[model samples]
Target: MSAVMISRKVRKWEKLPGKNTFCCDGRVMMARQKGVFYLTLFLIIGTCALFFGFECPYLAVHLSAAIPVFAAVLFLFVMAMLLRTSFSDPGVLPRALPEEATFIEMEIEAANGNVPSGQRPPPRIRNIEINNQIVKLKYCYTCKIFRPPRASHCSICDNCVDRFDHHCPWVGNCVGKRNYRYFYLFTLSLSLLTIYIFTFDIVHVVMRSVEDGFLSALKETPGTVLEVLVCFFTLWSVVGLTGFHTYLISLNQTTNEDIKGSWSGKNRVQNPYSHKNIFKNCCEVLCGPAYPSVLDRRGLMHEDSPVSASSAAPSSSSSSLSFSNNSKPAPPTTKTTAPLIPNEHTPDDAKASIGVSAEQSCSPEDLPPSFIPPLASPETDAEASVAKDNSH
Candidate 1:
C-alpha cells in the first residue's frame, strides 16, 4: 500500500494573541467572545447582589424569589458553556479537499538550507465535476484535486478546510460543515436565555416598586437595586447579540460569509440569491430542507433553482462545479476526504523527472518555470567535458 500523508498536528482548543498556542485554525471567535460575555455577566450579577443587601435592611420576604432567579440564570450560564464546548469541537461533517490545493507559497528563510533563489508559485489548479456541477477549486501541489465547497487553505492548519468556518480558539476547534447546527443552536439558546433573564429582572423591579411603595421603595426594598443590575446586563447581551444574528439571518449568511462576502454577488451582474422577501429566504435557511438550506447558497447560487443547464452559468473551470442542478433535492455529499498526494518515487513521477517520458495531459515542456532546472552555461559544460577526457 502507498504511504498516505495525513495531518500530523494536534487540533487546537485555545489561542493567545500572537501565539500559535491553540488551534491556530482560521475559524470564528465564538468560544472566546462567549467567555468574555459570561465573565461580565458574573461580575454584574455579583455587584447587584451585593448592593441589594446593603440597601434593604430587611430582605427576608423576597429572599426566596432571589434564590430561584439566581438559580435559573446560573443554569443557563452553565448550559451555554457546555453547549459551546460540544459545538466547537470536531464537527460531524468532515472536511474534504484535494491534497494539492493546500500547497501555498511559503516564505522560507535562507537559514533553512541551500535552495533556489526565485520564489515558487502555487500549482495550476484544475476544476473537476462532482455529481455534475462545475466547481472552481485549487489543486494542492502536495495533496492533489477538488476540495469541498467553502474549503479553504488554512495557513496554520497547513491544510484545506471543507466548507471552512472560522477556526475558534476557545474550543480549539474548526467550525466546518458538521458542527454548524450545534453552533447555531448554542447562539439561539444563549440569546433566549439573555432575553429571559432581562424580562424577569425588569418585572421584579416593578414588583418591588408596587409592594414597598414607590415613594420609599429605594429604602424599603434594596433587592430592587440588584434586579436593575441584572436587567441591564441581560438586556445589553440580548440586544447586541440578537441584532447581529438577525441581520445574518435576514441575508441567510454566516459570519465568515459576511466577512468574505462570498455570497454577496458583488462582482456578478445579477444577484441570483437575492430573494423577494427576506423572510422567505430566512424561513428556508432555518426551517426548510436543502443542501445549502438557503443560507449556505445565498451568496453562491441563485435561489429558485436554475431553469436549465444554460441558465446557470457554467463554472469558469472544472474545479468549481457544484453538480448540474442546485434544486434537485439531493442530499448533501457524503464523501468528505481530501485527495492524496502521489508518491515522489512512484514510476509516474520518475518517468517525468529524467525527461524519459511524460504523463498523459501533463507535458514536461509546458511545466511552470519553477519546476524547470537552471540551464548550464557554456564554460561549465566545457570544463565538464575536459574533466571526463582527463579521467579516461
Candidate 2:
C-alpha cells in the first residue's frame, strides 16, 4: 500500500464573535424553555381536570379513566425527553462552518502496492457543490485540519461535526455523533405519548357523556361542546404529528435534517439511512444487532482518542496528534513505529488527529477580543498622572 496525499482548501469565514457559540447556547436555552412549557402545560391541565371533575356528577368516572391515560402519556413524554437528551451531542468533533469552509481533496498514491484487501475502489472524486456554489474551503482553526465530506460546523460547540446532523433545541443539545440514538428514541417516544393522550382523552370524553344520560348530555352540559372540540383538535394534531414523524423514522432521517431539503450533499443520494426495511431496522435499533456504531454514539469531546469508522477507508490506521499551531497537543501521542498503514487498512494519522486537534483548537482566546475580559483600568497616583500629562 502507498501513502495517499490528501490536501484541503479552506476559505476564510466571517469572524463574528457571538455567532460561533450562539447555536450551542441557543440549544441549551431552547431545551430549558421547552421544559418550562411542558411543566406549565402539565400544571394547567391537571388543575383544569380537577376543577371540572369535581363539578360534574359523571366527573369521577372521567377522572378515573384519565388516570391510566395520564400515566401512559407521562411515561411516553418522559421517555421522549430522555431520548432527546441522550441523542443531543456536545459538539466535540471537527466540522465545517459556512464562513470557515474547507474542502478535503484526497489523492491516493499507492506505494509498491496493489489495491489493499477489503479496500473497495476509492470513491471517485467529484466536484461537490452546495447551493450552486463551487466550494472553496479552508482549514478550520478549531478542527486544526480540513473538513471531511458531509461535515458541518456546530456553532454551539464551536467545532465541526461529521455527517452533519442538526442541533436539537428541544434537548438543549446537538444531535451529532454521541447522542443521535437518544434523539431518535426521543422522537419515537414523543410520538407515542401524543397518540396515547389523544386516544385517552377521546375515551374519557365518551365515558362522561355516557354516564351523564347520553341522549341529553350535549344539551345539558354547555361545556361539552368546548371539551369535545378541544379533544378533537388535539386528536387532529396528534395524527398529523405521528404521521409525519413515522415517515421520517422509516427513512432514518431527523426532523432538522429533513426540513432542509435537496441541499445537503448526503441527502441528495438515495438516503442510505432510509433504505432498510422498517421492522428489521426497528428491531436492530432497539434490541437487535443493528445498533448505531460506536462512532455514532459519542460527541467529539467525549470520544476516546483515535477515531474509527466501520466503513472508513481500509488504509485508515490509529494515530494520535500531539500538537497544533493553536494549542498544545495531547501527551503520549503515539508514534508511527509500526508501518504507517496497518494491515487493517486503517489511517493512524486521521484517527489520532481527529481527536487531538479538534479538542484543543477551541480555545477561549479563539473568541473575539470583545469577549475577553478587559483588564482593570491601569491606576495612577495624582502626582504620576500630572507628571505624565506635563511630559506629554
Candidate 3:
C-alpha cells in the first residue's frame, strides 16, 4: 500500500506560539489577557439594559417611539463594531524562518562587512523611501526580521503587528491594519450611544417632573438616576476618544505615530502614509478596501506537508537551488530542536564539506546572493577561493 498513509492534520492556530487566545476552534482570536475586554462588555451591556428598561418605555409612550428605535439601532451597531474589532486578526507578520533569517544576516554582513575587534557593530536599521520621503525600518530581534513600514512589535501580544495603532485592552486585541476601521467605528458609535442615552434620561426626568416635581420623580424611578450618572461620567471620555480618533483619521495617522510625534513637523520625517488631503485621508481610512489577515491562522497542515518533508530531507538551505525552491512558503527549520545559528557548522555540513571536490563546489560569484554566507571561518574562505578558481 506504498508505505501506509499516515494522516494527522493540525490547525495553524493550535500549533502557533503567538501570545493570543483562540476560540471557536480558531474563528475568534484575541489577546490572552482579556480581563479588560470583559469589563468593557459589562459597562456597555449594563448601560444599555438600564436605558432600555427604565427610560425607553416612558419615552416611547409619552415622547416619539423613534427615540427608543434610534437608541436600539445605535446599541446594536456599537456591539457589532466592538465584536468585530475584538475578535479579528490585527495584521500580524509571521516570524522569519531559519533559512530566511540566515539569508538576511548574510546579506547584512556582506553589505556592511566586518568591524574591528574593539569596535561595536552598527544598529540594524535600513532606510527606505516612501513618497519621496525617507523612512527607517528598524530590525526587530524578536520577530527576526526588519519590520516593514508602519509595523511595530507589541510587547503585550509578543507579536509584530503591521501598521500597528495601539494595544487596546478594552477590545483585547492590538489595533492594527486589518481591524483599525472597525475599532474607529466602535469608538464613534459608542460615544453617540452614551450621548443619546444621557439626553433621553434627562428628557424623561423633566417630563415626570412636570407631573410630580423633580425630587419626587427621582424617587419614583431610580434607574434614570443610575443611567444619568453612568452616561454623565462616561460621556467626556467616550466623546474625547471619538474626537481624538477622528483627528487621527483626518491625518491618516495612528495613535502610536501621534505619541511618537512622527509627523508633528518638528522632525525631519513627516507622515509618508498620508495623501496630503484631509478628505482623501478620511476616505482612505474609513472607506478603503479592507486588508486581509496574513497570519494564515486557519491553514491546515497535514503530516506530509512541505514543512515536514523539508525536515526529513538532506539540508540544502545553504545552496542556491534550495533557496529558489523555498521562495514560495517558509520552511519549518526554525521549529527544529537544535539551536539555529546561520553559520553554525553541523556534522552534515562538515561531512559534505569534506566529501565534495573543490572542482565541483560552486562559487559564491556564480550563485545568487540569497545563499551567500558571511566570511566567518578560514575553511569557508578557502572553499570560496577554490570555487572561484573553478568558475573562472
Best by TM-score: 3
> Residue 23 error for model 2, in Å?
18
| Candidate 3 Cα deviation (angstroms), residue 381 | 84
lDDT of 3 by residue, 147-225 (tens): 9999999999999999999999999999999999999999999999998889888888999999999999999788888
lDDT string, candidate 2, 153-232, tens digits: 66654556554567644455565544555555655554454455445445555665776766565555555455455545
- For candidate 1, the TM-score is 0.42
Show model 2 residue runs off by greater than 4 Å: 1-91, 94-142, 148-150, 213-242, 253-392
Question: Across residues 166-209, which tens digit of lDDT does each residue of candidate 1 receive?
Answer: 66543344555445444455556555654554555455556667
RMSD of each predicted structure: 26.4, 27.7, 22.3
| Best-performing candidate as measured by lDDT | 3
| lDDT of residue 199 for candidate 3 | 86
Candidate scoring better on lDDT of 1 and 3: 3
In model 2, how large is the Cα lDDT of residue 198?
45
